[model samples]
Target chain A: MESKVNKYSKQFILFNSIFIFCWLVISIFPFLWTFWGSFKVKADFFSRADWWYTVSGVNTLIETGGRSTLEAYINSWIEGEFWRAARNTAIVTFSVVTISLFLGTLGAYALSRSTYKYAFWILIAALVFRAMPHITLVSGYLFPFFQLKIWGILPTTIIVLVAINQPFTLWLLYSFFKTVPKELDESALIDGASYFQAFRHIIMPVMWPGVITAGLFSLMLAYNDFTVTALLLNQQNYTMVPKINAFLGTVEHGGNYMWAVASVVSATAPLFMIVMFFQRQLISGLTTGAVKG
Target chain B: MPHKTFFWFFFPSGLAMILFIGLPIFSSFFQSLHIETEQILIEVETCDPFGCEMEVQVDQEATGLLREESPLGRFNGFGTYLDRNHLAFDDLGAGWETKTSIRNFISIVLNLPFYKSLLFTLTFCFSVTPVVVCLGFVVALSVNALAKSIKGPVIFGTILPMIVTPLIGSLVLFWMIDAQGILGATLQKILDDPNLSLKASRNLTWITLIIYGIWHNTPFAFVVFYAALQTVPQEPVEAAIIDGASRFQRVRYIVLPHVYPVATFIALICLMDNFRVFEPIIGFSAEGVAQSLSWMIYKDLRNETLMLFGSAGATSMLTILGVAILLTPVLIRTWKEFRTDR
Candidate 1:
């Protein structure tokens, strides 16, 4: 019986390890391939005659007189003016994270403290808003923004993104705020502090972890957005994601598909670093609501 | 908090939501009921041309003035909703009358842009959600059994797919799976078909997209379930083990029940996210074979000649209705939970 149990367990472990190994390959190989291929010439990367050409870089040597080249990166970044889009992405994400947290922290704190039915209704309304496909909202925004003459600018996109980020931000921070002992703020209130003062002095210090996690998510939303930014912004004001999309359109004309590949790698680098550093917070943030429920 | 205090605290976020999120739904509804103005036409007589011919030409200035006067165009009164690009009510009625069979009727209905997109969107949503849940649970279990030192790195690697921007993620996969790319070439060799391309067929495109959807979403579900698995009570698992429950039986009875609620949460989120699967379609360039409702609205608004605001708006309204329907069960459950908490 003991030998039989051991044999079954050994089989289970082997299966699990093999499954994980395959999954890891599936998860990690595409990025590695793209990153490596981004350095090679397009001919070698997409070589139909020989797939090994991608690894050997024979075509890359013929085209660029080297095993790899930075020509794609230079072409995309300088000639294509991708830096402008990266700058715009930075501005948009920074402003969005700041404004979303500002509004979300105050609103979520209030919602967490209040016992009113309206507060519950507001959350439910936000839930509905969260479910609406962002393109649907962009459809509504186009005419109005055109009418107001605010289309094709950074501030307009930032404000719209901040509003869109609000629902998720409020929910995340609200859950975070719920975990804080109410007595922390109540004690400050009893000490003759105004409600705002209580929030500022008592609640703000302990709320950083939650606020940071929410800010990371908000930053990502603003950074990763394609629909709103693509539709709302003009050519000059494009963010990175939309700009990458625009590269797809113009690639065939210039035969600069490598520029797009290079830009994709460039765009994804920061997100890779972010995940590297913030994996713990991100995992916790993901599970907070799920585990609590 | 007092009402006065609470009001001030909530005001900024409330105003933002009201202006952008709340108002858009109403604006989209109103826009859906209006179509663009018709071009004004006037008779012009050419005395020397073909013995005094009279021609009707578009009066551009008059048309511009009309458009400027009412930018929402003329009130359409559900006409946009019933048009061929949308519900295609007339086409549906005609097809119904002349139907050869139910399958033919269904095919005819699906040939319409709206129905075609709806079918893909629903298929993508429902198929991706359950698979993600199950895959995630299995991955979570596997990872949970890993040694402590390697788990963090494994998690960091796993979450990369979920964390990267969807467009870029899809593009990375798409380039690999292009006809001449490594994976595509390998697939051709394996299948022994020189001309085979995943992008060439409708069913294959759908499969590729669904596969991409599963790839993109499973990590999120995995992360959530992994965390949930960590919190699974040890007592019950140990009790089952001591009670002579086999490994599978222990997992089935103890671990499954503990993580069931988290599974539901992951499913809810996956459904909501997958229903709006637009980016992958673009990245894969699968719009020729498959389009989501979001993609339809995007196409209308991006029309090269003139923006089809009314058509886009109508589709927006319908898509919003779909979201509401998807959300109904969760909302009902939340309402019940809220009542119980009170």
Candidate 2:
């Protein structure tokens, strides 16, 4: 019986090991394809026969001074106006994440620690707001904003992005805040630590992992977004993902392998870097997002 | 600082929420009733390329006009809801006429397309959620159960899919299914027909979409389920195993029941998501057949007619009605669960 159990356990482990390896390979294939493809020249990208060569057969893709991978990277950077999108994405993400974390932590504290009459109602409202789609809300805002333009149209678009991302940011941070025991707040209170101070000190420190997870998720969301950004942003203020819209039908647009390589590289690199840098936190944060209150 | 005097802590967040999130709901309600319009100059140009000055006419473009005291307002006690409802479906196709009879809404609820979409959505929700939940649970449990040495890789490998952007995945999918794509080429060869294609048929498109949805969504579901699974009481699972329960039996009787709350939560959200499903639909072009309520809403939003507003309202109404009908039991159950627990 003991030997049989050991054999069964060993088989289970072997099965799971294979499963994990397959999962890892499939999971990372797109990112890997885009990364490698980003290094190819425009000529190499377009010729289906050239890019389609089997791995065992040697190809001249590397030998002929084709726009090597590094050249493609440089062209993608310069041509895509990626820096501008990155800057906009950064500022918007930082502002939204910061404001959301600050307000959400406090609001969550109030709901958790308060003797207020409307705490439950506030929590319910927050959840409802979280569940409401961004498009529905943006539809109403579109009309008024159309009449009142701001800062030659750029700042207005960024502000709209901030507003759209706020609910999720708040919801994510609030979830983190709720996990802090009420007793911690009471203890801080007994120690004469004011609510603000306790939140800033005790609660915030303990919830840092959750906060980082929420903050990063918010950043990922803001950065990867296409729909609202495409609608709200004008041509000059186009985000990286929405820039793909330019490729839809234009001959100069979608035909080049260089552009495809550039797009995949520009979009995926930052996310890949972030995920690699903060793998644990990203997982935990996503985990939180998956479950409900 | 005092517990009772912490109202100041709530003000900023409350004010922000009210201004941003709260205002939009109210604004959507108000905008639905307005005669909305945009001035457009129709440039009448001969087919001369870049050599002609065009005559422009300002079309009488007062649009999205609401009927004063529309009967819908009287029918529903909430005038705003009625106005919103009128605006959503008023402008659908180029020449689509309004069918305001009670029978139309009933038909919408009971029609083949509507019901089929619902069934597809429900199947998607049921199958996808369980697969995700089970995979997530099993993976997390296995990882947790493993010797400490190999656990990290298991978790890392499972989550790599979740980290990449969906846009990239969709693009990669495009390449993988396009005629010259790896799978497409392989199939063309295997079938001994040069024209054999995945995108050429509706059945194939739906299959690809279902596969894509599963592939794209599994990572998300896995992450959530895995996270929830991590929190499952180890003691109970161990006790079940000690009682000589087989792995499947343990998961069924003990693990699944314990994870029921989280599963229910995931299911409700998944239902909402599966129904909305605009991104993948737009991305994959599962063709027009992939139209969900949200896609219809998106289509309506794109309509040049003040019909956009009416269509949005109609779509929203349909979506809300659908979700409310389907989710009432779940919500009631959730309420009961929350109540009983408290």
Model 1 residue pairs with clashes: none
lDDT of 2 by residue, A107-211 (tens): 666666655446655765665665566666556556556555642255665555555555566566666766777888779878998777877788877987777
Sliding window of 10 residues with minimal summed lDDT for model 2 chain A: A51-60
Per-candidate clashes, comma-separated: 0, 7
Q: What TM-score do all the candidates reach, one by one?
A: 0.96, 0.79
**Tens digit of lDDT per residue, candidate 1, span A158-217?**
999999989888888989999999999999898999999999999999999999889889
In candidate 1 chain B, what residue range of length 10 has the lowest lDDT sum? B233-242
| Candidate 2, superposed: residue stretches over 4 Å from native | A1-8, A41-64, A67-72, A150-172, A178-194, A201-206, A249-258, A288-292, B1-6, B34-127, B141-147, B231-244, B285-289, B302-307, B320-334
lDDT over C-alpha atoms for residue A28 of model 1: 94
User: Per-candidate RMSD vs. true structure?
Assistant: 2.6, 6.5
Instruction: List, for all models, the DockQ compared with the true complex.
Output: 0.62, 0.41
TM-score of 1: 0.96
Clashing residue pairs found in predicted model 2: A39-A69, B87-B310, B88-B310, B88-B311, B88-B313, B88-B314, B89-B310
